[model samples]
Target: MSTADGPSDKNIGCAIYLHIPFCVSKCHYCDFASYAGKSHLLEPYLNALLTEIGSASVQENTRRIGSVYMGGGTPSTISPETAEKIMSAVAKKFNPSASSEKTIEANPESVTPERLAGYIKAGFNRLSIGVQSFNDRNLKSLGRAHDSQRALEAFDMARKAGFKNISVDLIYGIPGQTLSEFAEDISKAVSLAPEHISAYQLTVEEETPLWDMVEKGTVIMPEDTLLLEMFEKTVTSLSKAGYRHYEVSNFAKPGMECKHNLSYWLGEEFLGFGNGAHSFINSSRFANPDEPEDYIYEVDTAGRAGAEILGDEKDRVLEFLLMRLRLVGKKLTFKELDEKFFPFGRHDKHGPRPLFDETYRHPLDWISKNGLAEVNSDGFTLTHKGLLFLDDILLEFEKV
Candidate 1:
């Protein structure tokens, strides 16, 4: 075990996230805190990460760990030995139980049989491979290094190296991708029978090359109608293939959901390490510096980065609702919400409190009336139609 504590009501084991910020190449649409062409800084980054871990280790004695996830620009870009050292440090610092689900994210081109074996030997039990797309043209357009064939080979290599729990990532809505092409990608991914699958829509972020192309009319996005069709197709296809549509964009085999991600949605405590990694614990949410060099300097000088405490009740309530509502099957019960946020029942004298404030109440009522959601003593959940408009629904919360 990595830590000394046991799971409890208030502390149900924390999750640990390690951010590996190095990538072989940058994807045009990626906005995550990762750097390309920073190979030379790998050793220095790892050393700083180790220092942070050592400083945080004492807290682990009181916190049992439930999961460990290493995400990156691409964790596979680093050496297996480097990966192993990281796992060793985590194991020493956190003392997680034997059953803790340890996962490492890899891109198709960066994974090898030897790397997979090293991950397993280092105590990682789960692997998340980023395939992005199965179409070579789409891959090139997305700036992904691997072609469809390489993606298949990487999945095969992970399986051969004894990874029983695997997740495959796919993206849709590329400018040139047709509905039929996206369907074929889904079918091929299902055929792999991975324990989990994540299908994400392509969004153009402001600082990315995709955004510039879209702004300049050099690349046109798929019509909203077409994107909706693709989403519906994905849900229908994955369901028929025996994968549960667990979250909005995630599908998984029974009992095979990604626990680490679930923890985040469920508001569990987690500690994040490395540049730009975020943590939500002790009623505060904060992040490490986004720049690699800034992170190193901060940790070296102050032992930890500055964190923000989410102390406002209204802000907390909104954040909670936003995250929890993403889990389609898990609605927030009225009793739970009342006790945590409202405390007392709605009152006419004060013209309703923060939750029952007109700002939120009106939108929620409109949602229920429009058949976009259901509200009752049990709580609130999105209707199937509501899922399609989740982004708009979330906007309602933001107004409060």
Candidate 2:
């Protein structure tokens, strides 16, 4: 960790995520809160974010943040000077510690040597670069701003800038993406030798341009069988390359797991800050309005939400299980299960609902019997099959 300060038991349990909402250009498939051409809003947005974080800081009983993740539209899209300002305010609240996992998400297009060095000076220790593909045609099809060469150079520059723990993000199952091209992308990523690799399947969200393309006559969506075949190839290729499939979409070298992301996966609470950032604390989950102007105004002055503590306990428990099951390798013990794992509902008479009992027995038995999960003295975990059908099984939780 940087020598900025130290973390304590009180504050270290929470992870802080600061959303940077400006990208040079938005990828066609992206649904994140990022502006493609809005360079003008950067400074004011930063000021608003700082003011909001300051307000939350005063109210925070949680002492030190365990990790600080600078994710988003494109964190590195800002000039190095702007990066310093954001990092400075973040330090005032979280205080980057020796043990803190300080991560910043950088797009390949923004990873200049100076940018990388500036991020380090700003106290970011982990770098997640968006290197979504190594194939030219596929890269173009995805509307990525960087070419294969730029991505390679960006990765090289980050390593040259002394980023010891780096992660590269790759996407598979793009329209017209072949199994061979996908494997080649994984092979190239392995050759880079990053500390971690996050291989995500391309799922077209309803409002995304890629989805619209599928709706129109513009693009061909990969079939289910082909996607499954691609998924298997990805698992095989990455495994042979020494990357462990630690989570459904993430792979890492041993001991290089993303602590901030893992916290989310394991159902821990975090205070998500910034425009469009989502937070889960005290059994409720919600977000600041996704509009940059609205988010900044509300969070800076009133603090996140117009105070929306929306979503109930059952919704909370189901959401938690959905995220946790993404971690195919780890298991949460029963000791950690009780009140936190399975949230209960009030009946019509204001008593515990029948599903509360179902949480303890039915769901676990059903999944285990179906070869979707297994449990020991430790609590349940997704089996290999479970990970692939994770979303499907999570739907079951929503029902219970």
Candidate 3:
């Protein structure tokens, strides 16, 4: 896919994220702030969400919204009217650009013709369908509600419903999964010809069923080498299929990148609404209460949900570096870094360094010397081999 440039930073447009915390069933490895068997809370939750949206102090005149993403446990499970109401509230609050990209996340089993039509009518131009795996056994093992066939059908249905910009999400490294099986999954997804693809490794979070199973020896994760092999295969296969590996875990066909997610990775300001939603604006970062009841009660009683500020200069710099490195696999330029994090001239004759660079310089130097990254006029960029150990590299930065 063609890797076209995204919107210029000078536009100053922000993004909006609306969280839908409902799902038909929770996956074994899932740890997001979503709940199952909470269908009854849908009405009250939507009401609370609408109230929060309406009450948000967004400066629409100054910061025009470029994108709005409706993500959740399964946003498609909600009725069309509810979806419409949510979009209506957004329309009432924000002034989206003429070509604003609006996306909604849905699970295969929860998607339907009616839901697709409703989403389009509500101004959603992109759909992210979670099809974790195309293998029946893997789907069953993951406790996902949809099977391989159902996932394909859902994709077809979305296409028929006029969703041209579609993204499919796939997971790799499931317990007992073989390399060939993963390759086949990638092949199937390529055949479907989605505009975008996101392939993530399965992480066994603590307190989750998958973690319990691993502790009990009932589930065995793939070895590190095997996982790396899978990652390599994903990159190779997707690249061959005309998808650009734009981000570490995401691929897109030409100008089809997920703009909303790019906003986050690029460190742009955005407003998030609903339970457990986070917002970064005016140099302040905060999150609403994670629990639905807490969120509802707070919004109802206080006329606004409370938020906890993240922290000061050091914290913001750390966050900005962490998020930006994941894109273009590169470090920030001295001028860029200085302007955003330390405007008071932290650079010397050699180059610019952050406040905490004293402790981190050695490790970063090692990374550069070891060829894990390259530093030059542009900035530091991870080598192809370095992408595999991205977490380890980021940990070194975190220690500083």
Question: Compared with the true structure, what per-residue lDDT tens digits does model 3 show for residues 1-400?
Answer: 1223322344435889999999999999998889999888888889899988888774632577978999987889888778889988888788686578899999999988988998898888999999989999999999998899999999999999999999999999999999999999999999999999999999999989999999999999999999999999999999999988877889888878788888887799989998989888888888999888899999889777858685876678678866776665445565676567656565755486554334357656877887877766545667777777777787767666
Give the poorly placed runs of model 2, Cα more than 4 Å off: 1-12, 57-61, 299-306, 333-335, 341-357, 375-378
TM-score per prediction, in order, is 0.92, 0.90, 0.93
Question: What does candidate 2's lDDT look like per residue over 352-379, in tens digits?
Answer: 6544434557677777899988865557
User: How far off is residue 157 in model 2, in Å?
Assistant: 0.4
TM-score of candidate 2 on Cα atoms, chains taken together? 0.90
lDDT of 3: 0.84
Deviation (Å) of 171 in candidate 3:
0.1
Q: Which ten residues in a row have the lowest lDDT in candidate 3?
A: 1-10
lDDT of candidate 1 over 217-289, digit per residue (tens): 9999999999999999999999999988877888888777788887787677889999999888776788888
Error of 3 at 166 (Å): 0.1
Model 1 scores what on Cα lDDT?
0.83
The better candidate by TM-score, 1 or 3, is 3
